[model samples]
Structures are given as structure tokens and as C-alpha cells.
Target chain A: MKHFIVGPVETYKEVQNIYKQPYLYFRSNEFGEFVKETLNRLSSLIGNNDKNSLLYLTMSGTGAMEATIENCVTPKDKVLVINGGTFGQRFCELLKFHNIPFDSINLKWNESLTKEHLEYYENKGYTTLFVNLHETSTGQLYDVKLLSEFTKRNNMFFIVDAISTFLADTYDMSKYNIDVTIISSQKGLCLSPGLSFVSLSKRIIDKIYKTTPSSLYFDFKDYLKNIERGQTPYTPAVFIMYELKAILDLIDNSGGLEKWLSNIKEKCQYFREQICKIGLNIPTTYNLSNTMTPVICDTVNANELVKYLRDHYEICVNPCGGNRANYMFRVSHIGNTTKKDIDILIDKIQKTIEVLAKRN
Target chain B: MKHFIVGPVETYKEVQNIYKQPYLYFRSNEFGEFVKETLNRLSSLIGNNDKNSLLYLTMSGTGAMEATIENCVTPKDKVLVINGGTFGQRFCELLKFHNIPFDSINLKWNESLTKEHLEYYENKGYTTLFVNLHETSTGQLYDVKLLSEFTKRNNMFFIVDAISTFLADTYDMSKYNIDVTIISSQKGLCLSPGLSFVSLSKRIIDKIYKTTPSSLYFDFKDYLKNIERGQTPYTPAVFIMYELKAILDLIDNSGGLEKWLSNIKEKCQYFREQICKIGLNIPTTYNLSNTMTPVICDTVNANELVKYLRDHYEICVNPCGGNRANYMFRVSHIGNTTKKDIDILIDKIQKTIEVLAKRN
Candidate 1:
């Protein structure tokens, strides 16, 4: 079956082959070099090219978010989190769980975090600003550049979760002055899920050293020490590392990150146009992420369309859960997806919608 | 190269093939079934047959250890950890980092925990007893039966890190009255690294419900809630989970856990006898684990021997690090290691030792 879920999108053939190789021992020199090179390439891709600045965690995207809160936010630090979707809400939950004092700018799922929204938290003695660059739940890409400027003027550390936005959009950690930038293996990386990465600036590293992390697994300092020798403090997902290296090499070979982002943009544009042509609503309040498009159901049932597309056609699209289950369904444009793949998916979705209309 | 590292061992051919399959979207019903079946099989293998008693963490073995501590141990709980080697030392560090009051029974790398030593902390109001059943650093297998009896009598919670010794040795979590048992995919399961499993007894879950975990990623309560629907709280290592299911099926097909343990025993015994016949020293201060055997370098240079075997013979063995680097090297008997592979490794090691003697 064809998978169009937001993350774990279809991978490149070479990436699949790389993941098939046997697992390497984490302590091996060969594996060390692989880790070192992968981190270096990833740093260059996200514009955080520096020695000993990035760390790989054997966890999911949420784990990386927890790491940032555990390492950067102390009890004394005031924090502001942009809560627009599920992932953004997670940051608020983590900060609360850790007993850190924080305020949240809660936005509806379809709402965007704009420069105007930053006015209340600006210069409020907030030491840190946390946000999901692209909220996966609503397919809304927040204005990270605006947030970056706001944080810079306020002298607050900026932590961005770029899990679904890294390769799909243009993200420069250095330009944004992001203290901690998080990404995962699945999503825009087009690899299997499990591994998450955080690129910590030197300032954030200093903060991490000063505060003791309550959770050992998500501790940034321990991972930093191990990454010095091109290793992780714990056993890593080695096969996924291999896939990561392969994907990085593929990106480098294809004219670097600029061309990669352009390709994803083209795919996203094609999908959005095709879905809109079929008379389905696409939310316009926020800038859309290049990774996936969320179709807003008004007249037709979104869940029924998702089920029909999966059953009648062997195509799988992401069906929303909770309150949005009836109104939204997402189709991914990342990974080895081509315009052709998007065209077929849009055609199948259109047919499913027509079938639903007949049933009504 | 032939790998004899403690983890990332040579996986079975079928398991490797299973890992090569395309990545599955974590939210799909198909993946839900995979998670359900894998957890059921793992619970049965470890003898935790209770409903929703196990949770899978997308991390290494250390992550699961941290999860148990974060979930069960409170600031008021007096903890006693067996500090025998690196893994045991890690638990102490985790407890210390979390500001939990705990004492440790410090044994040398080669030393085993005996009943005489247990008298010191047996009735000392220790609420929890933490141990590494098989210390991976020195291949020293601790006596779980004796520790189980002691914990049961003292009314203390027992937590075991069985990462390196789960299927390689005979382990029955229920029989041992273990509250939390941690295992990883790469060790005795003969799968790749990246996935760690924790089997929490009903007692521990009840305790976990009362305490809020400090870590969001390692939180047991969140995972327990998600596992009811056969999903992890966060995105998991999907490919590694596939390998885990395949390895568990292999164990079931080949006469269950008992037969699997006996097979590993034969392989370990063969390697030990062959090495001893060649005049190499094996530490006898504790019972050796079936997972790996640590060879003591009393006369020969272990580092040089390891390099020679890797370069000239293409056989890779685990070289000790830091203080133990000069004294010990390890050969693994877990995974798909056969008697012939043991013969080859032993032959190469013997040749390398002779070369070292001539150099001296």
C-alpha cells in the first residue's frame, strides 16, 4: 500500500538498501566515522556547522523536545512556548511536568504564530522561547524568522522543533540564532522513525552544563560528552544511522539543501493545487509546510474519504484523531515522492470524495 | 568482518530480511498489530503474561533503566544498586542525578554478589534493589535467584537490566518476582539495536500511577496508556520492531526459550573451553554469562591482539575501554554465533597471542 502519512513517508531506494545492512557496533571506529560524518553533513544542511555542536538521540521527535526542556529550562527561567498544534502543546506539557514556570501563547490548530503574537511575551523576562517551526498536526509552518528576531531582541534562547520542517523547508539554525534545533529520522529525513537529533549552540551547551537534567536518557550533557568521540552515551539505532548517512549523501549529491528544498516545494505545490482543484478546502490562515497538506472537510466526511481511499485504492492518507477527526486529513509530500505520486493520490482522493457524495 | 561485540551481534538471516522491509507508518492498523504481537511475544518470553504489562521504548537499554527509576523510585525510597561494572554504575549515576537517596553494593568488575555480601543491605530499609543480571562490561553473571529471594523477603521492589542476558540465559521475570525487567533488541534477541523493552509487573504499574515521572520520553504511565491501543507514546523504531518480531518468532519456532537458552549455553561453553585450552585466562571470580566471555590479558597485549585479529583475520572482537582496555577483550556467543565461528575466533586469537609473545 502507498503511504502518505505525515512522517515515515516512502524512502529512497538507496536509503532503503542502506538500512538493510547489518547493524554495526556503536563503538567501532567505522561506526564512529559514520556518526561524525552524518552529524557534519546534517549541521551543514541546517546551517549549524560547528565542531561538537550536534548530538544524536535514540528516541523520537518528542524525546528531543523533552531534552531541550530538561537541559535548557531551569526552575528559575521564565519560558514562552508557541502552542498551535499537538507538537507545540507537547512542549507546554513537558515544561509543566518539569515544574518550570512558563507561559504559553495558545493558538487554534489552524492559527499561525505571527510577529504580532510575540508582543505579549516580548521583554517579559522570558529566558527561553520554544516553538515547533512547523506544527505537524495543522500543517502550519510558523514564522521562525520572526520568532528568531523577537527572541534575539529580548535576549532569550530560541529552541525550535524542526522535526517535520528540516528538509522540507529552508531552515538555517545559525541565521535564526536557535539555541537548540531538533529534528527526527522520519519526517523530512525520509528514514524510519526512532532516532532524533538536537543541534545545540555553544550558549545552550553552557546552560546545559549548569543545570542538572532530571532524566538521564534525555540529558544533553551526557550525549555531548559521548559525541566528542563520535559516539552516543547509549547504544544507538545503527541501521537508521546508516540510512541517515545515505540520505545526507543523497542531499549533498543533488546540489545541496537549496535544491532539496526546491524539490519538496514543487511536490507540495502540485499536491495543494490538485487537492484544491477537487473543491476541498485548504486552511489559509497559516503558511503551509512543504512536507504535508491538510485537507479541511466541510461538506464531505474526512474519515470516510480516508477509509475509501485506503480500501478502494491501496492508498493511505493520514486521518486526524481527537477533535479534528471529522474535519481534517493530511497527505505527505516528503521522501521519494514525485509529482506523479501526488497526482495519483489526488485523483484517488477525488474519486473517494465523489463516492462519498453519491452515498450522501 | 565477523562481529563478536556484546551487542549489535550477528543477527539471524530471517531477522535481517525482516528489517529490510519498508518502513511502516506507526498509526496504521497493520503496525498496531505488529506492536501488539511483538509485545505479546516479548511478555511471554520474559514471563510477564499479565495484560498491558510491557512497554517498548525507542531507545537503548540505558533508557529503559532510567525509565524504571523515573517511574518507580521516589525521593523517599531508599535504593540499593549493585555497582559491579559500567551498567550498574550507570544506575547509581542516574539515581544520583535525579537526587534520589541510594546506596550501592560496590563489587569489582569480576566480583559477584554473594549472600554474605547481601546481609549488609538486605534489611536496611532499602525500598528498591537494582541490578544488572549480566554485567556486559566483564561478562559476569549475577545470581538473580538469590537476589530475588532477598528482595522478596525484604519487601523491596526488584529491577533487573537483562539487556545482555535475556534469551542467552534462562530468565523468568515472574518466577524471579522482578518488578521491572529491561532488555534491548541487539543482545540475546539477535536483532539490531535502537529498540529497548521494559516489562513492568502489575505492582510497578500501580506504583507508577501514583508518581509522575520526571521524564516525558521515559514516562511509564504514558506508555502504558498508549500500549492499550498497541502503540508507543512516541514514534518508535519501526524497522527494529520488525526485526524484534522476527527474532521472537524464531525463538518460538526453535523450541521456545528453554531450548534457545541451552543452545546459547553450548556455544558459550565451547568458546570458553577452547580459549582455556590455548592457555588464555577467563575470569573465574563470578559465573560467566552465556552472552559473552571476557578474556583476561594477563600476559599478552589485548589491544594489539584485537587489532591483529581484525586486520589479519577479519574477526572483530570487543576490546575493553579505559582502565580495562589493557586487561580484557570479549567474544560474544549470543545471536547467530555458531560453534564453527567460535573455532575460527579462538584460532585467530591464539595466533595473535603467539605473535605478541614473540614481539615481547
Candidate 2:
């Protein structure tokens, strides 16, 4: 309750202003137009080559992930999953739920994913490759472009869970030939957690037509059918949709895509520098996420450190969940987070660590 | 742009206040507890009877309807559906999608459904009966109690799409032996439109377990499995959950269930009386919904009158969509609507109708 837990990041005043009004119902044409405009802006931001690229909104980034698995794979379809952290394991869970056959290339939580893992799966004749562009659980960003090229060369569908990295990273869906890119409103979009979006390439859309429909609510075909009318198959999270529109306007007004990406880069660099100065090491050797940094502290208890920062300093950071909690804690730099906010977080964390050391 | 229309009645100020915050991420335990508490409050409001009754949430009222059908009936399964209004037509659509065999007892758009229909269907060996508590499109509220008794005597599963009725009507799920009851957040709950809920009796749960999985996302079993742990199978509408909690709190704080139902009844009476006083004939004799009034005005173009009211008087009223536009227009009395709001709406309608008569 004292604030620090990564995600659902403390929203800025401007972002909160949009959420204050009752969401105009989605059945109304006004909300429908807002969705259309938001999709156009996102398409422009991503530089999608296919004008027919479809954006389908879901409840969360996880929902989008489930949608990808449900929409892309049929029973007994072989899927190649790159597992580096909790999120990677999630793909395995989805595969299990659908009873689809999947082989996972397991990477250590502290390691970055390389192209070799994908190449291994390609040789094994896997028809679909699933990767997390930004593995939030481990704070590692994958070489998505390289993986996308490998999947394309192998004639396999490429799916990227870009939930935490989409806006922060240079994600050009056109250049990467990414078949499906998933994102959420809460992380990089800086809106809220209720909405997830999946942008579909024509290749994957075609594949979906052949796959068996497992879930009615997250059926990609259902989404595709209704999307033409600027409507979702089900009632969308209207307030989140409104917040997404507002956030898009803010992003567009803030010198557009390139500037926004640069801002994230700068923030990530600042965070990495601060972590290095504090003698903390980033867990993953691969490229770090622009959105968050998973740091390993030799002397600090990650969970206690998180609580100390929240209770004593009013700064919220996420303590890694499950097995990762022992050695790592994450600080997110996504959404409308600024250098000033990060600086405050750093100041609190430094003080907390010193007090924690004294107590030990 | 204008607000009125039957559904998505103006959200309460308190409900809007909760939506103003960034939706807390689903992984947060706080969010999970909030949803659990909301469900608990709903259970209390409905009055606890059977421990086997379960509340499940979906994206919209229609989504809940789809879930009810998809969960209970497999492909080629026999279903009895009452065809009366847009909502009932949606049940037909669900039946068509699942390729289920359905015998529909079609009632005229503005007609009431009686127990005789159920008796007729029961004799035909239909195991499942689908009915609407309030047919929102035609402003029809059926006698659910009579249908429930008939279904019980026949040992049939009774499903009710109570989207616009729920708290507005004096009915109990246990009393009617209604196996499945679906309602939306915005209509009777005074919340926004992002969430739909279904209350299932023990008999329906057993039927769902025996049925083959139809949809992954809309699977009632998955929802029921996770609901006990205060979790949803996917990311839920977090902010709406918060708003629902707030609305429930407000409802409870304001003298609980009895008071809320009484307020709705009072608003319905006031609106119906005002419409009659303004020389508009009620469209249906026996099936008037407490949540809204469908008025027949043959002298003026209903669409033009609705537009004039919105543009000139700054009053939002929905012009009926499609074929229904020529014969009737509806004004809703759901959520936090009061006599004052109804009076303003009636006044605007009177002026608009007078101006339309002059123009014609």
C-alpha cells in the first residue's frame, strides 16, 4: 500500500485527468472513432508497412499473450518458445493450456537471449517462434530484429511480447517482419493496466484463419471481424481506451516517436549509471530493457529493501517475484516517469540501503 | 456525443472518481482483493441462498450472454430461446455461432413473454431455456418468476439476460431457480460499461463441467476456477473493478438493497407518468422495463426529435437504431437517475416534439 511495486506506475497529473471522467460507452461512435485514431497513431509510431495491420485490444498484456497463443496455434502445433524469465515461462503455460506442443529454449534468468537459440529451434522445424522483446521479470531486452529475421528466413511466424518495451524501444514492425507484436497500456504506453493491444501482420492474420479457435473472448478472428467496424467483439475497457487516446496524443505532441524513444534511451542510461555507481549489478548481460532494470545486490534482501524504500522513502520499486526475488529487484522507468522521479527513487534507495546495512 | 440512449446511463460522479486513477496492475494483490470484495458485496446484495452460486465477470453484458450459452451448450445441443428484442436476438446469434440446435418462441418486438412459452418449449423436450429479464431494446421486462417456476417444474436450466434489470427489478435468483443470470456494470450497477457479471446456480456449474470447452477466454470453468482465489483467468478491467467497489460501497452506505431497488422503481414510475402526460403512448402493455420507457410518437420523426432535443436543449436521448427508429424511442431510468433527470428529459422531449410538429 505504501506505493513501491513496479507497474501501475504512479500516474502523472495530466494522465490522471483523463481517467477522471466516466468512460463514454464503447458502443458509441465517439469512442469507436477514438480507437480508430489511436490505432492510426500507434501504426504511425510503429512504422507498420502493411496498411491492413490490425490492432486488437484486450484486458492486459497477458491477455494479449494468451490471444496470440490461442489465435496462432492449433492442437499439436509445434511452437518454439524462448524462456528467459517468468514471462517466458508464461508462454509455456499458455501452450500447456491449449495442449499445443512447444519446445522451450531455456535461458538463465540473468542471461540475455541470443539468435543461436532461435536458430536451434528453426533447425528442429518449429513453425512458430515466441520471444519476449522485453522480459520484464528479468529486465532483459531480446535482439528482436535478429530473431524476427531468423523466423522469417525459416518461414515461421514471429511473435514478440513487447508489453514492457514497445514505446521505449525502436520497434519498427515493418523492418523486423514481426508477425505479431503485443503491448499493454500500463507500461510503455503510460496509461493503465486494463488494456492490451496486439498488432497483427498479414502473415500471421492468414495463419489465424487456419488455426482452431479455442477461446471465444480472445479469438483473433473475432477481433479481426469486428475491428473493421472500429469495434471489439466484446465491450472494451472504455476508460483505459480513453486514457490510451490521451497518452497517444501526449506522445505525438511530444516530438513524436523518435523523441519518445530517445527519451527512454536517456532514462535507461541514467538508471544504469546510477545502479553502477551504487555498486549494484544488472542481472542480465544482454541488452537491458528501456523500461526497467533488474539489479542484483550482494548484501541487501530484495523484499526488505523494497519495503524499506516504500515505507521510509515513499519510493516504489518492484521486488522480483518467485525464484527471481532472492537475487534481483526491479525499478521501472516506463510511462511518464522522468529523470526527476528516478533521481528521487535513487536517493531513497541509497538511504535505505545504508540504513539496512547499519541494522545488519 | 450526446449522453442519453437507453444503456450506458450516465455514470455516477463517485464512479467516475474511481476511474480517474491509473488501473492498478492485475498482479497486485490489492487489486485482487478489491475485485473479491466487490463480488462479495454483490453476493450479499443478491442475498445468499446456495453456496454453489458463483459470480463471474466478463467484458460486457453480451459477452456474459455468450459465455452462458457457450458454457452450457455444446455444438448440436438443444436450447430453447425467447426471441423478443435485440438482447434476445443476441442469444440467437450465440446459438447460431455454436451450431447449437435451438427452438425459438418469437414474440413481437413490443410483446411480453409469458409462462405459456416455457410450457410449450418444455413439451418439446428442450433442456435449456434462455430468457431476458429486461429486453433493453424494446423496454420489455418479462415476468421472470413465472418462467422460473415453469423451468423448475420441467427440470430445465433457466438462463436470464438481466442486463438492464438486475437491481431495478424485485427478483431473486434462488426464488426463480435461474441457473444463469447476466448483468452489466453500467446499466443497473451505476458503474461503467467495461465489466459484465454472471451469477450461476449449482446446476449450471455442473452442466458447464460436463460440456466440452467452447471458448478459452469466455470459459466459465476457467473463471470459476480462478474466482475462488480472487483472480481472473486474464487481466480484468482493473479500474472498473475499483469503480465497482466504490459504487457498491455507495449503494450499501445509502441504505442497502431495499433502498436502491425502491429508488429505481420511483424513477421508472416518474418517467412513465411524465411520458403519458406528454401524450406519448407506451409501446408495450405488459412488458414495461423499470429501467426505461419506450414511447411511441407517431406524429413526429423520432430521430429528428431526439436530435433536436440533444442539439437545442443539451439533453442526450437515443434515437432508436435500425427498423425500430420509425415506431419508438427509449429513455432510460437506470443507475443514479432521479426524478429531476427524468423531468429534464421529458421537458426536452416535449419541446422537441412541438418543434417537429411545426416543421412537418
Candidate 3:
């Protein structure tokens, strides 16, 4: 089967190749160098300053986001979260769970973050801003520069969940002045889905060490302290770390990050064009992430379309959950997906849509 | 490299074979059935009643312990934790982190939990007891029957972190009336290290639903709601779940759970016998879990011996941490370890000690 799903993304052959070998003991100096090297490569890829420290957490993207919040934000800080999709809402939910007071910019599912959304929060004593660079739920790519400029002006510590957008889009944490950036393994990294990580600036690192974490496992201090010897406080997803290094090696060897992002953008554009030729269209009302296109399945039931592709052609795409299940599904271009794979999926989707439309 | 580490153990060729394939997406109906079947197999293996519900978490074992506490225990309960080793101390640490007031039965580094230890808390109205079936750090296995009887008479909820001992030891959760059993993937399951699971009783499930979790990612309510259809609330370690089923299949096909446990026992006995021939002995003052044996290395520095074995022999074992680093190490028989593998490790370790002793 072909993977077009947003994540647990289609892992490349070379990336998953790391798992066929023996599991590395994390405390070994050999494994320590491997872990440190991977973190260094990730740091270089993100183009962050020396002050930015990397933490590899064995959790989902949501867990990493919670860790980011627990480490960086407290009740003393008034936080502003942009809620345009499920993930953004997750930040708000976590904030509420932590009993931290926060305001949110709630947007429609199809809406994008704009300069106007940040206007009201300016000079309102908001100390932090939380956003998802690409809201995968609704396929909206928030303008990073717009939000960065706003956070810079308002003196808000910017936090971005770059789960779906890291390598698939142009993101320079240094350029954006982001204090914290969260990422997962399966999305842009094209690894398995268990590992997630966050990069924190020196300013937040000091703040994090001062604060006692609500959860012991989510504590950044332990992870940061252990990284000095290239270890985690607990047993990590050691096999997944192998996958991370392998993927980083592949990216470094194959024309680096720029070519990787461009390839995803090109495939995304190509998939959109092919789907459009067969009367399918993207209905989201905003600029999109290169990772996935939110396709409108109005001619055929979206769930039916997803099943048809999955069952008949062995292609899988995002079956939009909740209300959107009837009309919207996502076609992802990230994670080992190529133009050929996209062409096959689009060709199959084109025929499957016709069959389902006629049945309806 | 051969693995004898307490965890990230030597994964057999068969278990590692699962990683050669693609990563599965957790949202599929097929994945749901696969996950449900794995949980069912685990439940049967644990011999728990239908009142038990299983949760698969993409986290380290410590994360599972934290999740168990968040769901099953609250601040109102007067808790008693057994602190015999590092893993036991973790439970105390988590309880302290959650602001749950608890008393601990602090044992010496090599001490075991005995009837005398439980005698003090007998009539104190303690509502719960936390334990690690096998304290991995010191290779001390607590007597489940003794603890079970004490908790049964006192009417306390019993939570066991059976991360290292599950498949290696003959444990019957139902027979012991265990309220919750927390396990990790890399240990007795013999899979990758990223996934952890907890089996909670019906009583605790209802209690979990009523209480608000301290962290959003750890909210058992959301995990429980999603598991209705064999899904986690967030993206799980999809590939690891596949590995879970693969290993479960291997166990089922090859002599079932009983045989698997027996084999581990045989291997542990063989390793201990072989090590005794080399003048090394089990040092801990307790019954041992078939999982691993804490070895006293008084003739050679523990860390130095560990490095020598790893660098020259390619055999990995637990290099005892903290103060025990000079004289203690542990050799595990969990995961993909076998009798033949143990013999090889013993032979190499014996010869390596002579070389190290001469150099010293």
C-alpha cells in the first residue's frame, strides 16, 4: 500500500533501514556520539543560534507541545494561542489543563492567521504566542513572517509547532526569533511516529530550569542535563534515534534541506493540478502548506473516496474527521512521497471519484 | 553488537525483522483490529479478567508510570510506595511531583521487599501501594504473592511496574488482584523501546474517566475514549505496534506464554551458573527475576569492565550507575536473549576479566 496519510508518513527505505540492525544502548559512548550528531544535524538544519538547545522526547507532537508549555510558560505569563485547527486547540487545552490563564485567536477551520488576528493582543501584556506553522487539520499555512513580525513587535516569546511544516516548508527558527519549536518524527522527518522533539532558546532554557515541571517525564531539566553526555534521563526510542540519524544522513547527502522542501512543494503543486483536471479541488480558503493539500470531495463522499483509493489502489489519504468527513480529505506530499507516487494516487483518485459520483 | 543491557535489549533477528517493513498509520480499521488483538493477547497473557482495559502509549516506561498515576491515583489517597531501587524511587518521585502525599518503605540498595517491610503500614489506613515487580537497578524481584496478600487484607489498590519482569516471570495479574500493571515494549515484550502500556481494572477505568488528568497528552479519558475503536487519542508509535503483534505472534506460535516464561527462566539460570564459574556472583539480597541478574564485580571496576566488554567483545550489559558503578553490573536475559547468547556473553566476560585484572 502507498502512504499519503499526513503522518506515520511513508518512511523511505533507507530511513527505516536503521531498524534492521541491533538496538543501541543509549549510554554507550558510540550511541552517545550518534545521538549528539543527530541533534547537531537537526540544530544545523533548523538554522538556530548556539543558544538553542535540542531535546528529543519519546512522545507524540502533542506531548512535545505540552513539554514546551510546561518548560516555557507559567501562570505569571499571559499566553495567546492561535486556534485555527485541532493542534492549535490542543495548546489551549493544555494551557487550561495546567490552569494557566490564556487568551486565544479562534479562527474558522478554513481561515488563515493574518495580521489582524494579532492586532488586538498587542500591548495586552501577553508574554507568549503559540502557533502551528502549518495547521494540518484544515490545511492552512499561517504566514510565519506575519506572526513573527507581530510577536517581535509585541515582545511575545514565540512558540511554533512545526510538526507538519519543518522540512516541507521554509522555516528558519533563527530568522523567526522563535523561542521554542516542536517537531515530530513521522511528519516532515519521514521517520516513525513515536519520537518528538523541541528546540528551546537559551532564554527559555534558564526559565525552564527555574520552574518545577508539573510532570516528571516532561521535565526539560533532566533531558537537558543528560544531553551533556549524549543521553536521555530514561530509556528513549533508541531504534527511532537510528532512524533519525539515517534520515538526516539522507537529507544531508541529497541536496540538503532546500531541495527537500522544494521537492515537497513541487509534488504538492503537481498533485493539486492533477486532481483539478479530474474535477476535484482544494476548498480551504487560505494559503496551504506544501506538506498536504486539503481536497474537497463534494462530487463524492469524502470517506467513500478515501476508502475507494485505499481499497482499490492501495493508496491512503487523510480521511477528514468529524464534520468534514463527508466532503474533505487531505492528500499529503510529505515523507518519501514523490511525483510518481502522487501521479498514481491522482490517477486512481480521478477514476475512483467518477465511480463513486455515479453510484451516488 | 550483542545486547545484554537491562533494556534496549538484544533484539532477536526475528523481532528486528518487523522493522524491515513500512510504518503503519494508527487510524486504519486494520490497525484497530491489530491493536485490539495485541491487547487481547496481552490480557490473556496477564490472565486478567474482562474488567481490565489496556492502553498503548508512545512513551518511555517512566511515562507509562506517570500516566498510571494520573489516571488511577489522586492527591486524596494516602499512598505507600516501595523504594528499593531506581525504578521504585521513580514512583515516589512521580507521586511527589503530583503533590500526592505518600510514605515510602525505603530499602537498602540490595534489599528486597519482605513481610516485615509491609508490617509497619498495616493498620495505617493506606489506600494504595506502588511497586516494581522487579527492581531492575539491583535485580531484586519483589514477592508478588506477599505484596498481593498484604494489599488484599488491607484493601488497597496495587499498582505494579512490571516493565522488566512481565514475560520473564510467571505473573498473574488477576490472581494478585492487581489494579494496574505498567509495562514497556523493550522489556518482556521484546519489541522496540518506544511503546509502553498499562492494564487498568474496570474500577480504575471508571475512576480515570471522572478525574481530570494533570497533563493533556496524558489524559487517560481521551485515550480510553479513542481506544473504543483501537486507537490512541494521539498518533501512537505505529511501527512499534506492528512489532508488538509480530513478537506476540512469535510467542503464540512457539510454545505460547508459559514456554516463553520458562525459556527466560532457563536462560537466567544458565547465565548465573556460567558467571559463578568465573567467580562472579549475584550480589543482591533477594530473589531474582528471570529478567536479569545483578553481578558483583569486586575483582574489576564495573564501568571499566563494561567498557572492555563492549569495546573488545561487543557484548552489552547494564553498567551499574551511581555509586554501584565500581563493583556492580547487571546481565539481563530479557527480550531476544537466549541461552546460547548468554553462554557467549559468559565466555567472553570470563576471559575479559582476566585481561583487565592483569592490566590493573
The interface root-mean-square deviation of each model, in the order shown, is 2.3, 3.8, 1.8
lDDT of 3 by residue, A249-320 (tens): 898788988888888888988888888888878865698988898998787899998888887888888888
lDDT of 2 by residue, B1-360 (tens): 335555566777777676454454465465567667768778656644554355556466766777778788776567878788777887887788678888788888756677666665655666888988787778778887777777777778888887778878776877777777788877778665667888888877888888755545666778887877678876566666787778888887889888988888888788888889999988756668677778888889887776677657766665676877876787777766667777888888888888889998
Q: lDDT tens digits, residues B1-360, model 1?
A: 788888788878778675346555678776787788778988998988998888988888888888888889989999999888888899999899888899999997867779998897767798999999998888888999999999999999999999998888888999989999999888888776888889989888999999877777877888899998888878888777787878778888999888889998899898889999998889988998888899998778888888888878878889987778787899988877789998888888888888888999
Score residue B44 of candidate 3 by CA lDDT: 82
Model 1 spans > 4 angstroms off: A19-24, B19-24
Q: Could you give the fnat of all candidates in order?
A: 0.77, 0.33, 0.86
User: Candidate 3 overall Cα lDDT vs. reference?
Assistant: 0.85
Error of 2 at A219 (Å): 4.4
DockQ of each: 0.64, 0.37, 0.73
On a 0 to 100 scale, what is the lDDT of residue B130 in model 1?
93
Candidate 3: the clashing residue pairs are none
Clash counts for the predictions, in order: 0, 3, 0
